[model samples]
Target chain A: MEDDYYSIESILAENQKIQCTFKIDVPDMGHLDGGNERDIKALSKVQVPLWMAYILIYSDYADFTIPPPFSARVRSALNAEARSVRLSNLVGQAGLWYGFGRMIMRLLNDDVAKEMSDVLVKTFRDRLPEVIDQAQHFASVHASSADSGVGGDNATMLFREGLDGTERELFALAQDSTRRTKRWYETSERGRRS
Target chain B: MALPTPLRASVTPAELELIASEQLVEIVPLVAMERTAFISGAYGPLRPPTKCKVPIWMATNLKLKKKCRVVPPDWLNVEFLEGRLTQETSEAGFSEMPFRFAEVAKVLLDVAPDDFPNPDKIRSLLKDIREARQAKSREGLSKLDHSELSLPNLCSMEINEIRPFFIRAMGVLTDLVKEAQPQQDAP
Candidate 1:
């Protein structure tokens, strides 16, 4: 699904950078590293966009390392408590952590790919319940406050700030449904009064 | 411009309520009337003080004009809803309810609160039941997997509330699963 051409999320995920170590000397591509050198030296590391890295890595031009978002520290942190990790901060500004991880998984070999994919799935599964709870909580809070804005305590705001793109979408969906249900309840009561 | 949020694929609570209005309800007529025909079906030869089975929309229309009294469905009472609430809180799964129970109950309680005994208590009981069920749904979602999730006896309104979340979550799961499969096959 991340491969969908029309999906803006997928596009942003592809635009994310992946650090690759060059296996062959490539002239004129030193600009990728923002260096003045005319040729990218063999064994030199350079950060390339995920989309371009996919081709270069497959065509035997480079070998990419796991990006900082999926590093061992993040892995253990996720294992410790998946809900507390701030996924939005992990993937820089776009906050497409899951999508970026999936794209990176596609570029890896078998055993490592399986491990990375499992992390993505487990993190998403672990955090989903909390995401949904906050959405419903905010929905009711929004309803009762009656245009007082999307009101919630500091904890909820802090938690919401941690959501990745996919979880953000799910949160929006759940909040919307709850709001509609609240509106329906109110209108039904109005119908009774009239 | 894109379609409004509620109009996108999933059914809204209001739309579900409209559909629930088609359900047949028993009403006590104040004035006699001949059988009437409509697209859905023909409903009845209502007689004074005599009961007739008509769709809820017609019942609401007649009740609004002071022509009839709606007979609340059997399960709308506080006693029955309280029983369901106990079952919902005690059980791990959902209790069986009328397929459109939420929508129908809201419509009935809205259009004809006077017909039911102790409408306030019933309303509060229904709210309690809903909260219990929602808690169960969240628990179910916590165990969600890429393969399947079975939540039997969920009513229409409950299903609609979680539909979008479930669909998108499953989509992501499928993507993850599909990515993992080829790796296992290759090695």
Candidate 2:
């Protein structure tokens, strides 16, 4: 019969020195239901180094350099395939509000976060018509160009023409996830305020 | 089979060659002076009163191409280049250094019109400076020694003093554009 349990005694180990790089101060929680005994506990604290934060922020999109992962690849491919759709131009307008929503959430609660997320989603959805119209116009302009060979009639075609249904669904899912994160942050803030 | 003989062609009539004349525009390159000669009155006892040089580059158009010519007669002696203005004297081993074009633009753009000779001229000068720097950079190599480059002291000054100037300049430019829009809209 095979042995069911692994013994820690048989495991090899090496001793190493560990040094703490950062210190975080947490509020002391006094003892609850104590019988004339003073007990103080420190709240849990996590320390993230400046270098690490810089790396994480710079490395990933939707932070500073690039849009969220969902929009990044889509935007790049679209830009390459069609010259008229400039993904960067949308950032200062719609993306700025989206970022604000995210910031408000991280500073606040889950419920308020969700509400903010809903607001952002609704805003984006409302603007979707304009966005689609702009995209179509750009496509037509490119298609009309002599080098494009594509006719103006086919220029207004959306990503659905090239991408499968699953891919389009995935993009929608990613966008929803981004919105939910923002909503969660807003909710957290509202909870704190209440 | 034998090859057939080639037929000879004959000139039927004399034709007149018409030449079209068009005006050729001659592009004249603009020469702008760069670099400033500063005569500082003795304020400190460390060294005798001396003349310090500030190098400047002015960007101008040469026909179809934009060219940058170095201004301020003795820029190499001043040891000024882009990027390294903020380093302390102790760290940099120099009392003064040159600032980047961006930094200089930020400073000049910040200075109040009341304090400077001519604010608009200064702004233009700063733009030319920036253009020159950019043109030089795009040339694939830097003219100055990279290791010795430094930023000017003016840029390292308080941001508050400089920030408002840029805002004002931007506002003025925006107003100009707004004013021009109506004329453009007119039939």
Candidate 3:
């Protein structure tokens, strides 16, 4: 639980940094960042909030470097061992991660984003059966143990029961992902503000 | 004002309202309105004596306008809810109910309690169902402290009912995690 909390917090911090991080070619924005240099070729990476990033991305004035967990590393991880990793954080903060990734994918048409989306879908579908099996088995064993007195044949399963809500939490996260995905298509027909 | 409840899952009256909006309500129209539209798609041509499938909102509006008499959902009856409560207790499960049961019941009972022979019976049954479910959730919560590694399958309503208990359990679990963290970090 502590590890999850720490990892989630660290992930959140990284996301926050990314939200305020980007590379823009605009000159007016540099003056706001307290830089004295007013040269035309002084283009450098700057950290700005996502709201500003959207305008830059939309105007085709800036290039968004794909942040961590949405990178090729995660794609390789999915191809390797997706289960050991906490995939819920990928769709972090009520679909912020997925929504942003999707928006970036659409805006840039980056193949990396495309691959990430494919791997996410595949990984989620693959993980579903195992998660359901574990959840149901854990639930039944817990129920039976409660019914019985001391111990049961499924004593081995009891160790997995108190899993800090990984399965159910992921279940909810997956549902949120589905909903966000639908909204993406529904509202994407509009010019990307919805 | 009641305290807002903490929940593990996102379930609320809003979901019930979503279900309620799709429910088939029986309405007998007094004023003939030909296929009217009201946000949630087109519905109408409400004719009297010929019962039609109207959404709950349309039925409510018709009832409010003194146009059509809204035949409350069949499950809204006192006897039915009492049966549901019994079933909920005996089977440790619930039968499918009309969405927004509590909200709709309160609306109907508040507006036209006289339609039923004993309105208080229905209210009491709803109260009992609520109380019993809350109590059942509390039972699961009470045992949470005894075992650190137990996961309980709580329905949405039960989760809402056990909000405070859930917070307490979370606090305990957080402390436990904190206690375990240092040892693991000490390599």
Candidate whose lDDT is highest: 1
Candidate lDDT scores, in order, read 0.85, 0.28, 0.49
Tens digit of per-residue lDDT, candidate 3, span A19-137: 32334445444564457756323346655544456666665565667667577777787678655455446554333333344334443443554554565445444444444334334
Q: Write the per-residue lDDT of candidate 3 for residues B105-171, one digit (tens) a residue.
A: 6545554455556778887887787666545543443344323524344443333333433444444
Docking class of 1: medium
Candidate maximizing DockQ: 1
**Models ranked on lDDT:** 1, 3, 2
Question: Regarding lDDT, does 1 or 2 come out ahead?
Answer: 1
Kindly indicate the candidate among 1 and 3 with the higher DockQ. 1
Q: Cα RMSDs of all predictions?
A: 2.4, 31.2, 18.6
Model 2 chain A lDDT-worst window of ten: A9-18
Native contact recovery (fnat) for each candidate is 0.53, 0.00, 0.00
Runs of candidate 2 with Cα error greater than 4 angstroms are A1-73, A76-194, B1-130, B135-187
TM-score of chain B of 1: 0.92
Clash numbers, per candidate: 0, 27, 1
